[model samples]
Target: MRYIAIDVGSTFLKAAQLDVQYLAITNMESIRMPEPLPNENPLVKEWNAIQLLELMQGLIDRQLASCPGCKGIWISTQMHGFIITDEYGVAVTPYISWQDERGLEYADKLGSSYFSALMERVGEEAWRRTGLWEKPGVAAVGLFHMLQQADSGMEIEWEGQGTACPVSMNDIQTLGSKRLCTLGGYLIQSLTGSHVCHFTNAAPTGLVDVRAGEWDIDIVRAVGCQALQFPRIVVGTDIVGHYHSRWGAIPVYPDIGDHQASVLGSLADATNEAIVNMGTAGWISRVSDAYHIGEWELRPYFEGSYLPTITKLPGGRNMAVLVRFIADVGQSIYGTALTEDTLWERLLAEADRAAQYFKTGKGQSSNGQLHVHVGFYGKQTVADKGAIDNIDSDNLQVGGLFAAAMEEIAAIYERNLYVLATAGEAIEQITFTGGVIMKNAFLRDAIAKAVGIEAVMAPACDEVFHGLLRLALVSEGLYASVHETREVLLQAIL
Candidate 1:
């Protein structure tokens, strides 16, 4: 048997055909996400739900045309984004991108005192169900922003300001209210006509009860949702629906979150290994059944388990800033601009040379003081401009600066890992992924050195794609669970 695994990403919709029995990728393809409307509001980000669904249909058509034996469709989607749909599953509003921040403004409008008081009242209940705090960009906050706008007679625009559509307000306040679901839930409903979501996908929305796999209606009502709708929460292995094509009827599994799917796809053993995915955003996660509520995010994993995750934004974004700085310097000095790739190549070479110089006792090291804090969301400090301290003439070059940045990143990872260790979740092995870490071998070594752990590169494949495939297999009853299939499949591939 075979399966078509799809990853609905923010920038692209990726699809792959895999032979489940042999655990091999037969083919893969990607379609760039449909561009959003140009708007004056930088906070507004929206995508066309109808167009995305059409793209998915086209990709599925192409896959089935070539590989006629595929039996299942499993999806892993970008979480937090949401859409409002009519009863027939047609989109009534544009898909709200997770990047949208109008919800943050709405959150601020609640006033700190009132917000804190409300959190105190609903904090335990919300976290008990959702396994997440009231993050500004999640779906629940977005919904609040939408409903409050409708109530206040403000135009319902994506991310607070854009091209106004009073029609959306009418649909929203219609006598029989429409439904709201995350991007994954929207797709599942569109495809299978089922209002369903997986617990892993629902946990991030700030509306689900993580343990019960159901929406907390009281919390929903508290958010000013008079008649808000939620998809039925399902487990990872349940066959939620089926798609009938000319080839055959293929079972469809509920969608999973890209982060959780990436962890599974990274093939880390849950008992001892922690997965570190470094991309445009960075996340470090480990799986366990025990749910410890803290500053870190607690997400639903497979089989009613939980994953403790620490997310950071300083991965590729910080590296990009450094590369651009070097590129600008080269442009000014050499009278020619350097491309990002070329600058990184030069940076990696320089990093190697600097490492050798330090090894030979000819260069200075930061001694852990020169920290480059990447404050994408003000997690560290809103006013903190990242600094480089204790600099000397011997280590003032770009190579030293770049190396110091890597060390700082490594140090942050080490600190978080140490905290997890204190909490009795000691990481025995580290697996690394992300364009920055995967391309730069020295960065991986630096992380391994700083964290005091041996780091291995994640499988050089689309981890989310493979992760969803394993879930599809489990849904087909080929294995007892996602974790079991993950172990057996990873052992075979590794």
Candidate 2:
């Protein structure tokens, strides 16, 4: 069987074709978005979504035309990129990336009690957890929690759009201007043709009933939308649908955001097992048999079959941030796209960019490197409120400061891993995936030393995609369970 995996990450988007039976990649390519699009451009927003969807279909046609339709085409995308849309699936608002900090007000509304309760059950989301603690680049898991608080009557207000938009984590959805439907479930619909959240997707939405493993009405109202409209939850392995015929009519398998899928694909979502995937971005997650809520956070996710709660580390886009800062040091002699990469040739080119960036910033060495923090998942912030500026040259330094900043990032990972390992109370090996592992030797060595665990890379970079195929084989009943699928994968690929 062949599986086409599309990874829609916070940074670059990628598509791949894998031969599950042979454990081979017949084809793979990174989906490219035209650069220089402004934040609020409607054309940029709507067209990007639609065009990318089409391109994904096209890739399937190109790669699998000879093999007939694939068993499943999986989408492992970024989570909480809350984009509103009309009935036809046209985007109503620009895509709000996982990095956006615009929802801090919602964090304030979550109230001490709710957050306290959540902490006792699960950890807080990354958007603000590190501010109280001071970590960088971690994902903001609290976004869902905060959004929920804003929607509920237990309301509080903070400055937003001049006055405030109401503290409602009940992420609203509309079927055109009719306002006939609304819910946290619209996120996946806006991206794929599907109009539902996956089983794992719901857990992180701060809307799933942790105990019941089902959607919660109260939580749905909190995001300010009806729960019914969201995509119906399905196991990560279930067959969702087939790609529209325009692209190639491949089968579509919607899923838990990329993070959870990575945990499974890497075989890290297991008792005392873990993995850190450092791609164009980075993240950390642990798989337990059941959910455990620690004192400082709420249970972010609870799969019926697994208890895999994750924290987005601060390493992903920061690589690009550093790469640009490095480039700004001098004239990029060759226009080679070396912001971040591991391809032998690409790395050498990026090195030249870094060299130039370093030389130019020598005098302004005090420009000082910036540290990106994480809370498993991070939404980084600084101690001082007014001490911030846009992430251009002023805020992101690259000299002696850069070295200092890298040290801080390394420390943040090591320290947080210690806290989480202790907080969760049981853990062992930490695995790694994504692009960063092969790209940055220094980072790999540093992380290995910091966590005090031997890190293993996915034998194949396309593990996530092939892993999807494994899930399809199970969900489609070709095999009885993940273990059986694993046995075949090990025999064929490993």
Decoy 1 TM-score against native = 0.88
- lDDT tens digits, residue span 44-149, model 2: 1212333444555565566556556566666666654444445555443334444444333323445543334343334344222221221211122233443354
Clashing pairs in 1: 129-208, 129-209, 129-210
Task: State TM-scores per candidate.
Answer: 0.88, 0.67
Off by over 4 Å in 1: 34-36, 106-109, 112-121, 157-170, 246-248, 328-339, 359-361, 365-371, 380-396, 423-425
Task: Please report, in order, the local distance difference test score of every candidate based on alpha carbons.
Answer: 0.72, 0.49
The sequence of per-residue lDDT tens digits that candidate 1 reaches over residues 166-244 is 2356567662557777788887787788898877787787777776777877777767665766678786466788777
Superposition error at 334 for model 1 (Å): 5.6
Query: Candidate 1: how many backbone clashes?
Result: 3
